[model samples]
Target: MQVLTINGQRRELDVDPDMPLLWAIRDVLELTGTKFGCGQALCGACTVMVDGMPARSCQTSVGDAAGKPIVTIEGVDGKVAQAVQAAWIKLDVPQCGYCQSGQIISAVGLLSQNRKPNDDEIDAAMSGNLCRCATYHRIRGAIHEAARMLEA
Candidate 1:
């Protein structure tokens, strides 16, 4: 039995230590918001917060994450996350939506570090997350909007 704090809840999951945190989140805990894009972590679809920093769930092992707090898209909260969500909705950032959750997670991470990010900063921060629908423009706009909303 392995106990991990996920989304502010202590969850005891009976699983292998080598299992990816993505599997623990989706298969075990049933939180499917974080996606599986590239298992190699090249794509940011499996992004989540581990100890308040963005981490690729696909590459993170359950054992390594045992004592840290993990926050999935389903459990994202606070002003920065809320602002990002609202901006995502207001800007209509999703096309197919498969990558939105990860995009949102990455956005939250970026805004948490720098409340105001320029286009270059946004590009640098969001470069890992890929949207097959190619909504990069809208995503950038949403990030900017989220930043403004955070300031307000």
Candidate 2:
């Protein structure tokens, strides 16, 4: 058994230490917001915030995630998160919406560190996240809007 601080709550999970954090979050914890895409950590669909930094849950082991603060789409809060969500809504950034949660989490992670990110930075930060609907343009727009909202 390992204790994980998830969404500001302590969760005790009895699973293999080598189990991917994504499974622990989705299968064990039933927090399905973190998706499973490509499963090799190449796709950003399984992104989650571990200790306030975006991490690929599919590649992260539960043991490595132990004792760290894990935040999923359900647990995202605060000014940055709120701004990102608001901007996402305002810009209509989702097409199929399957990957939006991971996209949102990645956006929040980027915005948390750099409030104002240029297009290059946004692209670099979001490069790992792949949207099947090809909503990259809107995603970029939303991130910029989120930064603007943060400025306000």
Candidate 3:
């Protein structure tokens, strides 16, 4: 059994100790917003926040995540993800939209630390997320727009 603080709620999950935190979130908790892109962490599809820092959940152990505060896309709200979501909607950033959750989470992580990021910074921060739609430019644009909205 593991006790996790998720979306500001304490959730106790009776799961395998070795199961990936992504599985625990998706299987046990039924929080499907956090996706599984590549199990090896090569893709950032399973991104989530561990104590406000973006983490690749596919590579994270459930036991290791036990007792840690976790936040998923479904948990996202308020001023934190609002601007990003708004920017995303306003910019029509998603094509296929499969990678948007991870991209958004990564953007949130980047924006949390650096409000103003250059193209290189955006590239560096959003490097891991693989979008088959090839919407990198739009994603970058949404990040910038989100930053501007947050600043306003």
Give the number of the best model, judged by lDDT: 1
On residues 1-152, what C-alpha lDDT tens digit does candidate 3 reach at each position?
Answer: 78888889998888887899999899888999888888998889999988888899999998888878888998877685899999999999998888888899999999989999999999999999999999999999999999999888
Task: Give the TM-score comparing model 2 with the true structure, all chains together.
Answer: 0.98
Judged by whole-model lDDT over C-alpha atoms, candidate 1 comes out at 0.95
lDDT digits (tens) for residues 1-152 of candidate 1? 88899999999999998899999999999999999998999989999999988899999999999989999999999999999999999999998999998999999999999999999999999998999999999999999999999889
Determine which window of 10 residues in candidate 2 has minimal summed lDDT.
92-101
Please, what are the lDDT tens digits per residue for candidate 2 over residues 17-96? 89999999999999998899999988899999999899999999999999999999999999999999999999988978
Instruction: Name the regions of candidate 3 deviating beyond 4 angstroms.
Output: none
Our tally of clashes for model 3 stands at 0
Return the clash pairs for model 3, or none: none
Q: What lDDT does each candidate get? A: 0.95, 0.94, 0.89
Of the candidates numbered 2 and 3, which has the greater lDDT value?
A: 2
Off by over 4 Å in 1: none
lDDT of 1 at 103: 93
lDDT, residue 38, model 2? 96
